[model samples]
Target: MAKDDTGRLHVTVKTGGKRKLSSKLWLERQLNDPYVAKAKREGYRSRAAYKLKEMDDKYKLLKPGMAVIDLGAAPGGWSQIAARKVGSAEGKGKVVAIDLLEMPEIPGVAFAQLDFLAEDALHRLREMLGGGADMVMSDMAPNTTGHRTTDQLRILGLVEDAAAFACEVLKPGGSFLAKVFQSGADAALLAQLKRDFTTVRHVKPAASRQDSSERYLLATGFRRASAVL
Candidate 1:
């Protein structure tokens, strides 16, 4: 471990035969990230937990007894935070999560191994939620294609679908938060959000990597579904 200019100890990963430069760099970044270390120390699943924690601190999105739906909740980091904040463990609230990959059980979360984009997904999620959700949050990210424009479009499409699902399941005055990239496609989604929500804004939590273009679109006070029609 070597100390960087910021006085934080940075771990360097040595690249060799099978280890690609990109893999080495990513490993080094994870080793040196303070949030990664903190997450391990706190027993959280991943460093991504801090992103939701920070956002909830600022926005007060989670409340006891509120129902929450998590999209693309893999590895269960965000679901863990939501479960605790909403008191799902004590049955004060409910947290239902869906992802294409299977996730290990989180004490207070109900996980479904299904793609959120599937035709039957919304209906299944609504059944799991049991009723309209108080909040819908997503941390879904597309597999990078190495092409900047293509990657951005994919991210936009994922967020748009998440937003549309949020509209379908969220109760009046509910909230929606989803991960998005810094790209032109966000404008269209923002316009739709403005029409359906009382307030819509973008947030970049401190836990997100400084070099990353990722940000979250937070829309709150959702108008009744009839209002949009």
Candidate 2:
């Protein structure tokens, strides 16, 4: 394989091979993915870093020394980026990241291994934070069922849970960012975010595959229910 100017591999599918067409296509795309190349160069865990990087660049959410919570932070990509942007957990800035899979420790991030929707997860997260967070980001997506409607509902559930958790833990003027399939962020979730936030918008970062329906719902300015309602 040869690399292009962007560092992405120049790969092509062969006519005949033991690999199926799907497998060949997947391999070709992975080899050609710009985010994958950029991730390797940047030492980030996953290409997902570009998603957050793009989002942060657009929203100006991350700041040094801010307290942050990262839900579904697996492989530590977002956490790695957050650590550099938000400082270390033991430092003036704190980042608490939780995921079902264990992520290697990042210098400025505190990792918790558990299910975000588990019985004690929220309690433990709060204990770890010691107070409300300045920003809450969740890239959580449910394992797809292949059935479009089912998959959409499942992902939407994760987004809703993440949003509710953010509402509970985010300080006023805080921000919430979560991943959702384009069709999954229903009216209720959008309304809820709008009710609690000054700005609620859906964004599809360039890092996401063009064929994918996934996007991020970015909500800023948390207006606590007690204050607004």
Candidate 3:
């Protein structure tokens, strides 16, 4: 093992043992990732929990008793933070976690195994939240093809759809946050967000790896009357 630039010992993986180079590299990175270790100690499900935690810490998002929606919430990492911060576990707030995949229960998150892109999904969430939401957060990503251009299109398409959903359910003055990558959202989406919300910006939490191009697109102060919804 050798130390990384951070002076943490880098655990090297062997090339053999039927492990593909890609898989071996991924395992080694996970083993050495500080966020991964911290998540375990803090009883969080994934390293992503810290990303939301850091942003919320700085932005003062997720106030108690707010009705929150979590899209692409599988593994339920973001849901856990939302529930705790909003006091959902104590029954003072509401958190709905929606995902294509199912995970074990979190203390206060109401999990929905449904596609947020589906026609009925928005209606279902609206009904659950009594037609208004204080915040919406997404950690969704599309299944990537090996082709870079195709993958980028898929990612942007997903972000656009998520933004549309946020515009619909969010109350006036509500907020939206989503995970984005590469060059971030497309121009049209960015324009749409700026029009529909009072402020739109990109944020990269310290918990996110510096080597990764990933970041978060955050839009706050929804203008419900100006939104297409």
Q: Per-residue lDDT tens digits of candidate 3, residues 43-97?
A: 9999999999999999988999999999999898899999999999998899999
Comparing 2 with 3 on lDDT, the higher-scoring candidate is 3
The whole-model C-alpha lDDT of candidate 3 against the native structure comes to 0.89
Model 2 Cα lDDT, one tens digit per residue, 146-167: 8999999998988899988888
lDDT of each: 0.90, 0.86, 0.89
lDDT of 1 by residue, 1-229 (tens): 7889999777889878899999999898888889999999998999999999999999899999989999899888999999999999999999998988899999989999998878998788788878788899999999999899999999898888898888888888999999988887678789999999999999999999989999999999999555221
Clashes of each: 0, 1, 0
Ten consecutive residues with minimal summed lDDT in candidate 3?
220-229
- Backbone clashes counted, model 2: 1
Q: Which ten residues in a row have the lowest lDDT in candidate 2?
A: 220-229
TM-score per candidate, chains pooled: 0.96, 0.89, 0.94
> Which scores better on lDDT, 1 or 2?
1
**TM-score of model 3 (CA atoms):** 0.94
Scored by TM-score, the top model is: 1
Give the lDDT ranking, best first: 1, 3, 2
